[model samples]
Target: MSYLRFDKTLLTNLEESLTREVLRTNRSGAYHCSTIVDCNTRKYHGLLVIPVPELDDENHVLLSSLDETVIQHGAEFNLGLHKYHGDNFSPRGHKYIREFECEKVPTTLYRVGGVVLKKEKVFVHHENRILIRYTLVDAHSETILRLRPYLAFRSVRQYTHENAQASRHYDEVENGIKTCMYPGYPELYMQFSKENTFHFQPDWYRGIEYPKEQERGYDFNEDLYVPGYFEFNIKKGESVTFAGGISAIDTASLNDLFTYEVEKRIPRDSFKNCLINTAHQFLNKQGEESYILAGYPWFKCRARDMFISLPGLTLAIGEVEKFEVVMQTAVKAVYAFMNGETTDLKVYEMEHPDVLMWAVWTVQQYAKMVSREAAKEKYGQLLKDIMTYLADGKHPNLQVHDNGLVYANGREKAITWMNSTVNGRPVVARTGYIVEFNSLWYNALRFVADLFVEDGEFSFRLNQIADKTAVSFIDTFLNEYGYLLDFVDGNMMDWSVRPNMIFAAAFDYSPLDAKQKKGVVDIVTKELLTPKGIRSLSPKSGGYNPNYVGPQIQRDYAYHQGTAWPWLEGFYLEAYLRIYKRSAISFVERQMISYEDQMTCHCVGSIPELFDGNPPFQGRGAVSFAMNVAEILRTLNLLAKYDNQ
Candidate 1:
């Protein structure tokens, strides 16, 4: 039996089918997303969404969806699903869905009366393109397939309407048409594999409601433009493909191009293979450099996420060349920031100061895979430049204190990953010397100091600073509550039992002693550990909010309060293995293996962003989050490394 195939019993259930979503992405920053049954329920759900550099840097929805119809013996069967105003599902095409499977790609089979049809979708890598192939499986008579394209031509954040200002013209290309409805946007070229006629008719598809957007308390209704339709005569055992992209495509070799792309994909036959395939999709190349995209559906290349995910997403899989490219790209961003030059290094603007420290620690991880001498030869200057800028207190509201610990404050909201604001105020306003920040600071100082050991004076100065920071770390963050204090400003200490405390044991050079390390792990395991990950806040803590639901404000308030972030599992497992040593081999394997079942359950092999803190921890964030998947892959690598005694 296929591991990821869904029969009609599940696909026909509209409520169950709509809850599961599928995503396909290309290296050119384009993606196709929709429900398992080809029904769109979110504003972010689109067949072709890409970054329009001329208009803005964010993604714009060009082609929202394609409605397909099959006709046999003068009888028509609608195989498309849509939602309109007043919670109505028009055409109700999901009832014809016989099966849905996601192995190498997402494929759906539709059985209308006696005619069997199969549809396969794949996003072309390194290009802004989507290919959809339709094959007639078991048709007794000749059949015709009709495809209607629904164009949004607006930013994903906004809805379009039936306005007169919109353009309604098309230019003929290859075997199809090209159109750009708005100014300052790239035109899209759409083509079919066979000879076809495009009827010159235009109409408005109005009152289309997105249920996911409505739940988020945003305007969910929009109007789409349908530019006629394409009709093709399909026969049994014959296949036809539709190509959509920003530039004109060669229709003659379209099938060959699709075949080449499909052949390049890695196998996804097992749980581990599925993860490997998903991990390969996160890296996108532009010109001579490559960067890691934070997540799919709706995310950009963020600096903090890139650093955090680089080691696992690249190095752990023996992708040393790509790893170096990503590191070089990030370091260049820091260099540009220090020199006050215009840069494309768009990280989280209100980022925690620890992100820079994580970049340094990532270098240390890379050194283990390669050699320190080799790393120094390639990245020595960039690393030194970053440290010099940090020591000089160049960044906003961030400074190295006289006591040697880094102090990052004065921001209206928190700067770290927990920096979620509700109604213009940070929900968890932690402003001070955060525990994780100081731990990373101490490790970075020591690691960089070791790199300059041949230079005596520089090495001594760096080690001296790290030594002082170690003393301050114990005095300020270690507490009588059996765990580390979350953060401190002046004499005020925030003793919230959060997962941030685990980093002290997980870092390359933790200041905590053996007794202290065991104490930290014990407290975290008892209070914050769950099957999915560690909760952001302990249940006993006053600020703990178990559910992450509701509108923007409510979700923000609960984002870091008690939501369980699966990305933290990497650090938690690393710390546990550090304190427990080789005795943790069996335990680690069992715990990590338990998540294999989850691969088939949610998002089809990729992990999600977060889960509820309560029991039965239902996933509650983005469907296929890159950070969570990277951490899981890193944990598996760690287990293999430590279990081989």
Candidate 2:
């Protein structure tokens, strides 16, 4: 049996199946995502979504969906599903699905009368293309396959309607046609592996609703254009391939190309392999530079997320070369920011208060995973520069105090990762001496000191400052309740019980002693820990909101209040194992099992961004998150180390 397989009982149920999505990416900022039953439930769902760098930084949906109809003796059976206005689904293609499995690729089997058809979908790597192969498994009579292309040539963030500005003209290519809906966008080429006749019947399919967008309190209605349908005869035990891409290709090589791409896929046969495969999807290689996308469907290359996810996404998977390559691009951006120069790198928010600290920590992880000598040889100068910049108060938002701690001015903007805002004001304005920032600050100083131990003068200065920061960190954050406060600003101590304190215990050079670290861990285990992950805020706190649902504003309010973030669980588990040692291995293993069910939920074979903090924690936010996947992989790597010992 496949690791991720859904039978008829689940596939035919819209409520359960629609919640499960499948995502395929080409490593170059293009992706194909949709529901398991081939329904476009969200505006982000598309068969071919690629970034048009000429127009803007955002991704555009070129081909929204492809509707397939199997004709037997002139009787047509549409295998396409779409949600119309008023909770109505047209074509109802889900009913014909017998099985859906995603091991090598997304494969679905359908049964219609005397025909059994198998459909497999694959997204070509490093190319803006999607190939789907259709095979007639068994048929007693001749069959004709009709494919209708639904084009929504617009930004994924926006919807399109019927307009005269859209060119109705198309250019005929080899065994296909190429058309451009707008002037700036790239032309979409629809082609077939074998000879097929194209019929031009352009019409707008209006009022198609995206229920997921409507649930999030946004405009959900859209209009998709169907230019024409391609019909071809099929014989039993024969296969035909369809290609949708930004550029035209040789029709004769389509079959060979599909086979070559499928051969590169790593089968999702186990949980670990599934996560490894998911990790590869987040890597975006653009020419000489590489970046780790924060999340799927919407997020871009963010500095904080890139560093936080780098170690696990690459180093933990034994891809040291990739780790260094991505770091080469990121280090350049970091150097440009520190030197007061602008860079053309596509990475954003390079000046986040703790981004430099996180970058140092990521390097520290590389040193730990590979060797200190390797890390020092490659990133020694970069680490020295980052430390000098931070210690001298060179950062715009970060300030070094006399007490040897870093203070951030987050009141004016959402500087930290809890960056939700309303009306230009931060929701959680944690201004002074954030707990995690100080922890990371101390860790960075000590790590650099250890790496460059030969430099006696620099090492001594960093240790002296680290000692002072350690003394101040315990005095300021550790409260009477045996837990650390979230942040401290003068007399206004934000006493919200949060997962930020986990870093104080999880880091390699933690300030807190053994007993102190245990006190911090105990409170977190009692209050914020859940099956899904560590809650952003303790439920005992008055400001806690458990459900991340409702309208946009409401969801933003709860985004970091009590939403359980899977990424935080990595730190919590690491801290637990650090304090309890070998005795905690069984507990950590059980906690890892809690996430096994997630491999089949939300987005199959991957993890989501956040989950509801309450019972029956439903996943919320992005379908697949890089930080969540990376952290989980890191935790798995940690577990393996303990097992080997």
Candidate 3:
């Protein structure tokens, strides 16, 4: 569990939701620097900002509200700022960003009536069952301008360890504290409070105001990862929900919000070990299942995300209870998807074809993983029905194409993730023959095949599903040159070398031998490899573009052409693990070119959402995605165990 910031109503990354981020991506000209640092306070894993507001300097104010920001963190940022950057620059003399190792936990805020409450979770050690739930009350506000707040907190840990020092100096400092030049105009800032609250500071006090410039003792709003509390402001009689990443001092939670931190120490599963312990840190923290597919950066809820991320986020890592909760939430979506309640079905979501496929896969996978027999029976049977619906092509007015892929709002695009678009045309969603879709299909077929494998149990139906897949993979997908086509019936540029081919056999479905697998790997490795991770396509493709740092529209148009997605890094790693089951070490060497190169040289540990499509690749887009990080870590764990002599 890297780090998550959530409230009862909304959940998002704690570091991400800070109001200061608005400055980083600001259309105005405000710079932001945020980091997860030790209480001792020096910047480590420093995520600097080369703020590029979406607006072209119509207004220039960082502290005011505008959403334009340019986030450059870790190695990706280092390269972009140092080598490839244009006007975007980090401070002139500060050392470049590097990934620092610090075990942080999920942070949360909740609104309970007028009192907005908060919870901070910390896992000092993964194997340990100890989970510290630090609860506090967020300050409220009448107006952000005039507000003062107070808070109190106590740490109740039986086990103790010293926190690394992170006092920050604009340059460097011993306690991690550096007096700001005392005079400079930067968008974000930090400082220490002069007053006392209940004899000591609160366990956690966020929601500080970001000044238009740095004030000596102040740094970034998210700099401190400590368990102590700080105070801001609260409106006297105004209502508060008890959760907020930042506050203008609307309402205050007095003694009610303050309490000794409680360690809801649950027993760790002695049964299995891997990244499970870390996964549990995020997944097991109260109500994690309900929030799945809910938002991006952890936003944007979808049926596909809940199930696709179920094992890694909820099940394999967290408690069994979360599995049930997520399964419950997802099963409804599965049925809805099978019945054609796509993202477009709701007024909020425009429809798409991927939901059905993702739901079908999730329902079955959930059924398979659930330890309960009754749930297995019910969901398994439901899976069969869903699979049958997919087999027969069951949308009412919608016709399934010859190759079993669902089309967008009647003849439009939109099948898989990468469902973003520009000027009404789908961006990177290679509809007809997406690699992962067929990979997922192959998995479903094999899942059924395994279920009835005893005496060729599912042999008839299994063989049929397998045969259909084989036909589709060979006849529909395989282009004359033998390379799998990227899409079935799109524009003329369907043969662009992309990561889609890896999915054909990554699961149990493909009839892929070493030769076919070798071809797919070769195409992707040569064309897709960038310093950050896997590029979306061959740089040589006509539609390809590598510069992902810019306005959303431009980014979307060039989105998949050459953007290096860390998510694809997982699939590529998975394919390597599957194909070279024996040559694990060698495959790992090839699979992790970016991580090895970038993590140490660029963004050390934290994986950025994407890299610029071109050379001197810089991380761009959302700072991180759970699936991406979890999968990369999973890949590393795979290498660790398999490579063990």
lDDT of 2 by residue, 495-574 (tens): 89989999999999999999989998999899999999999999999889989998889999998999999899899999
Supply the global lDDT for candidate 1: 0.83
Best by TM-score, which number?
Answer: 2
**TM-score (C-alpha, index-matched) for candidate 1:** 0.97
Candidate 2: where is the Cα deviation over 4 Å? Answer: none
- Per-candidate local distance difference test: 0.83, 0.93, 0.42
* Model 2: per-residue Cα lDDT at residue 416: 87
Task: Pull out the clashing pairs in model 1.
Answer: 352-415
In order of appearance, the predictions have TM-scores of 0.97, 0.99, 0.57
Task: Please give the range of 10 consecutive residues that has the lowest summed lDDT in model 1.
Answer: 343-352
